[model samples]
Structures are given as structure tokens and as C-alpha cells.
Target: MSKIASLVPESLKSSKPSLIRVLNNKYGSDPEMVNLTVGEPDFKTADHVKLAAIKSILDDHTHYPHNWGTPGLRNAISQYLARHFDLHYDPEGEIFVTEGASGAISTIINGLCEPGDVVLVPCPAYTLYRINAELCNAQAVELETSAPDFKVTPQLLKEALDKYGDKVKVLVLNYPVNPTGVTYTPDELRALADLLKNYNVAILDDEIYADLLYEGEHLSMAKLLPDQTLYVNGVSKNAAMTGWRVGYICGPRDVLKALAKVHQAAISTNATMNMDAAQEALLHGDEDTAKMKAEYDRRRKFLMAAMDKIGFEYTKPKGAFYLWVKVPDGFDGDSMAYAEHLAEKAKVAVVPAAAFTKLPVRYFRISYAASMEKLQKAVDGLAKVFAQDQAD
Candidate 1:
């Protein structure tokens, strides 16, 4: 018998890499590293939310839930959507609670895409969308949104639909975007909705950061195009419940039925305790979310001011806790190199723009999710590095 040299298939070998993990592994263990690479909130889950989870566990709400989700949790998610986005959804038919927002994206990819189907993803997007598309054997056609504003304009959407034609089955839209921290306005969402309506494309709207809008309220594309939108959200960012691993999807009944099949086969169901906890977080955690958002707003102002003083050009982000700043003039525009330089010299770790896509090279993402004191230290470290460069 011939020895098996390579057990994994070529498809698995050719899969896209995880940028967050790559950066984490490179700088995570360094004692002096001030990591601004991760996209998680730095706040703790509120005491009341935690108490609710403990109460649920103590009361023995631990049985297996419905394959779609617990009825109460689904109802809570529906109400949350309606109250926030003014969108109506029948919880029983339209909602499926998943492991996290990442799971929701995976479920949609598996449910919607067949072999060779194309997914339209804007560049500098949350990295998971492209990876999920690849996992489903679908082509992720990344349309660059590195224009004056990092948004997928109606013209760009039209061009992608025309180019990919019938192969394009899904378009991923993330507002309060990771890496870029840009959120779409209601008018902008409506225009894009109209353009997408012309095609048979389905939307995967990841509104995980919807609650962190510093400038104003977040506008959901799903509100305008609910029929074709698979809206994904969760408690991870808003309630600081990343470890709880609870998220949900709401969409048309037929689409949700398909996603339920994929979800059930993959994970069976989300843990009952976590779902119970999430129900509480959704229904009674508004105050917790508000408090965290206020703190994030303060850090946002400080980071933006620091970047300006350091001569870094950046868009004034309206939502999300990130600043996408351009590298200083005369520095090599390669963000990976700059990131490594900062990490080695200044002990500050940030994600490079190249990690998000092959669009431009002058930008890097700084997460303001750390405390103000740590953020201030990072700013001072960065200032010293820039000053040293200027002197040299």
C-alpha cells in the first residue's frame, strides 16, 4: 500500500487565512505589546446580565432547545429588531439563534451558496465573509470600496451584478464596519437597496456593531429590503458577551428554513443556557449597552485627536471603535512593515490594512477598545516613534 502523504484535500489547502489569528499569534504573547488588533470590546458584561444567566442556570433551564431556537429567545430577538429597526419578523418562522455572528455568516453561506456561486464582498470587509464563502466552495468577488468613502455605492453594486451575473447569489453588507468603522446612513442604505432589488441577489447584513454608533443611530439595509436580507446580529459586541457565544439571524421564512437545516446539521443547537442568557441580554440589557457605548465614544474622541496630532490622515468614523489611519508620508506604505515596526520599536500592536484586503497599503486599523489610560500610553508610544523617525 502506498503511504498517504497528504490527507487534506486541495480545497482545504487553498483556503483563505484568518488575519486576526495571524496577528494575534505574532504579538499576543509579548509582555510589553499593547495590542489594538482585536475587534472585541474591552468592557465586562454587566452584573445584571450575568445575574440573569446565573439565575437561568440555577433554575435548570438547561434542556435542549428547539432546533431553530428557544421560542422566548426568538421572540426577544424579533422584538429587539422591531423596536430598533422598525422591521417586523415572525419569530417562530424567521429567526434562528446560532453560536455567534460568525456562525450566522457560515449558516447563510452554506444554506444559500451551491458550488460555483459567487458572493460579492466589499474589500476592507470583515475577514470572515470571504473565508466563509471559500469554505462553501463559492467564489468571493471582492469589490474595492477604498474610494473617497469606504462604502459600496449603487454604481459599484450594479457593476458587480452585471459582471458576475447569475453566479452572484449573495452580497455581504457590514455597517459599523470592522477595520473601517464606517456606517451607512438611511439614504445611502435605501439607494443600495434599490440597486440590489434589480438583481436576484440575497443580502447577508452583519450588524454586529449596530449598538456602538457614536454619531447617531444605525440604519439597517434589512429594514429596506427585508425580503432579501439575512440580518445577522449578536450580544458579543453590544453586551460584551463574546464568551457567551450567542447570536441570531432573522430573514424571510423560506430562507430561514434553509439556514435552520445547515445550522442543525453543524452544531445541533446553541447551548440552552447561553440562549437563556441572551434572551435576558436582549430584553433587559439596553442600559448595559448604553453605558458601554458612552465609554467607547470617549475613547473614540481621544484616539481621533491623537491621530490628528501625529499627522495621520483618517476618516472621522461615526460608529464602531476603530480608527483607520494612513501611514505617515515618506514611510513605506506597506502596513505590515509599519505594524511590525511599531510592535518592535514602540510595543504597540495594530492590524495592518493588507490583512483586510489587497486594496491600498497606507492604512492600518487601531482599535480603541482598550481603556483610556492604555490608549493614552499607546498614543505616547506612537508619538515617540514618529518623532524619532522625523529626527532620523
Candidate 2:
């Protein structure tokens, strides 16, 4: 008999291993290593939220959940968005629960795009959008926001729109962005919205980190273009409920109704208890998020000041937990090697922004989601690395 093996799809087969996870695995065994890489919140889930999950389980609510999600969760998400973003989504028709923001992105991209359609992903960004588009057999076209300041400009949008035209199916916009920590102003988003209104592209507005705003308010893209915007949000970052695995999508009723098929095919529903927990968080965990944001703000300031003294170059973070740093001049190798070298010499690991880029670059991202003590230790290690760079 001939040997036989299952074939992995080309989209998944060629996927690169996550550099952040690679480095974490490499350096994770060290007892003293300050892993300033992953953006997981260090805070505990609110007691009330945890208790809700526990109560649900004890109350025998562990059955398979509805494909769309529990009515309570959809309603909670709708109310949460209306209260916070000044956007209204009908819980009955326009909202659908997903596994997480990641799952929701997959559902939307798979549902909205046919093969050969283009998903316009602005970089430097989380790698998921591009990779997911590839998996869906859709083209992931990256528009690199100009350097020094990483905000996407209207002219850039115009150029891409002119080039790709109707082939562009989705425009991904994630603010308080990962790695860079750059966000948009309401006026800035409005400018982009003006251009976008002319195009037929769907706006995939990812607001998973909306509650972590350390600077100006978070203005949802939906606020400017609700009809065209597919709003994605969740309780993971805000409620310290990442392990709970709950997210939701709010958008046009017809689109959401169609997307519900993809949601059902991919993942029927989140666990009932998890949805219960998530709704509780959405309803009552704003105070918990507020406290966490205050700490994250303090950590951001502390890291920026410390990096200033130590000679690591970066724009001041506006929101979210990651600080994107351009590798100082005279550093040897690309950011992956730089990161590995740092882990070996300084015993502190940071994610290379090279992982997030669609083009070549040399940058690393430090996550401030760790405790102040851990951040201080990471800073001390970074100072030594910079000193060595100067000496060399």
C-alpha cells in the first residue's frame, strides 16, 4: 500500500509561526526572565463576573448555546455599544456572539469575501487580519501607514481605493492598535470616513481594546459610518475575561443574518456559562476596566520615560498595552535576531514588530500588561542592552 497523509491547505501550510510565541517559548523557562511580550492583562477577572460563570454552571446552564448567542448576551452587547459608542444595534437582528474578536474576524471575512476579493489591512497591525484573509482565499493587501507616526492618512486610503477599486471587499481598522499603540482622533476617522463613503468596501471596525483608551475617547468607526461598518468587540481585554472566550458582532441586519451561517458552520456558539459571564461583565464591569486602565496608563508613562533615558526610540503610546519600539541604529540583524539576542543577554523578551508587518522593518513591541515590578525589571535589562549597543 502507498503511504497516505492528509494535506494541509496552502493557506495554513505556509503560515509562519508567531515570533512572539516563538520567543516566549524560547525564554519562558527562565525564572528571572521578564516576559514583556504578550498583551494579556495581569488583572484578575472581576469577582462578580467570575461568580456569574460559576453560578451558571451550578444552575445547570452548560448545554449547547444558541447559534446566535443567548438573548441576554446580544442585548447586553447592544446596550453596551449604545451607551459607550453612541451606536444602536438591534439585539434581535443585528448582533451575533462569537468565540472572540479573532473568531468574529474570521466569520466576517469568510462571510463577506469570495475568493480573489481584497481585504485592505493597514499596517503595522496585528498579523491576524492578513493571515485570516489568506485562509479565506481572499487577497490580503497591506497599506503600510507611513513611519515615525503610524496613523493611516486619507491620501493613503485614496491611493489604495484608486488602485484596487471594487475588488476591495473589506477595510480593516483597528485602533489603539497592537504593537504601535496608535489610535485615531474622531476628526481623523471622519476624514477617512469621507473617502470611504464613496467606496463600496465594508469597514471591519475592530474595537476589542476600546475600553483601554488612555488618551482621547474611543470613537467607533460605526459612529461615522454605521451602515457600512461591521463593529467587533468583546469582554476579553476590558473585563479581564480572555479565558472566557466571548465576543460579538454588530452590523447591518441583512449582513449579520448572512454571517450567522458562517458563525454556525465555524462555531455554533460559545459555552453557555461563558456567555453568561461575558454578559455580566458587559453589564457591570466598567469599574474594573477603569481601574485596570488607570494602572496601564501609569505603566505606559513609566515605560516611555524609562525608554527615553535608555535610548529606545518610540512614539508615546496613546492606548492599549503594547509599546512599539524601533530598534536603535547600529543594532545587528533584523528584529527577530535582535529579540533573541535580548532574551539571551538581558533575560527579557519583547515581541518583534517584524511579526506584525507585511513589509520589511526593524522594530519591537514591549507590552505593559505586566505588573509594575515586572516592567521595572524589564527596563533594567533593556538599559544594559542599550549600553552594550553603544559600546559596540
For every model shown, what is its TM-score relative to the native structure?
Answer: 0.96, 0.97
At residue 262, give the lDDT of candidate 1.
90
Candidate 1, residues 1-392, lDDT tens digits: the string is 34664876566778858877789788888878888888888998888778877888898988887988889899999888888778788987988899999999999988899879999988788888887778778898988886446888889889989988999999999988887888888888889988888889899999999988987666888888888899999999999999999998999998888789999999999988788888988999898899998999999999888988987788788888999887777685488888888988889999988888766657788999899988998999999998888778
Error of 2 at 266 (Å): 1.0
Instruction: Indicate which candidate wins on TM-score.
Output: 2
How do the residues 143-168 of candidate 2 rate in per-residue lDDT, one tens digit apiece?
Answer: 88867768789999899989988899
Per-candidate clash tally: 0, 0
Q: How close to the true structure is residue 254 of candidate 1, measured as C-alpha lDDT?
A: 88
The true-versus-predicted C-alpha distance at residue 107 of model 1, in Å, is 0.6
Error of 2 at 120 (Å): 0.8
Candidate 1 local lDDT, residue 250: 90
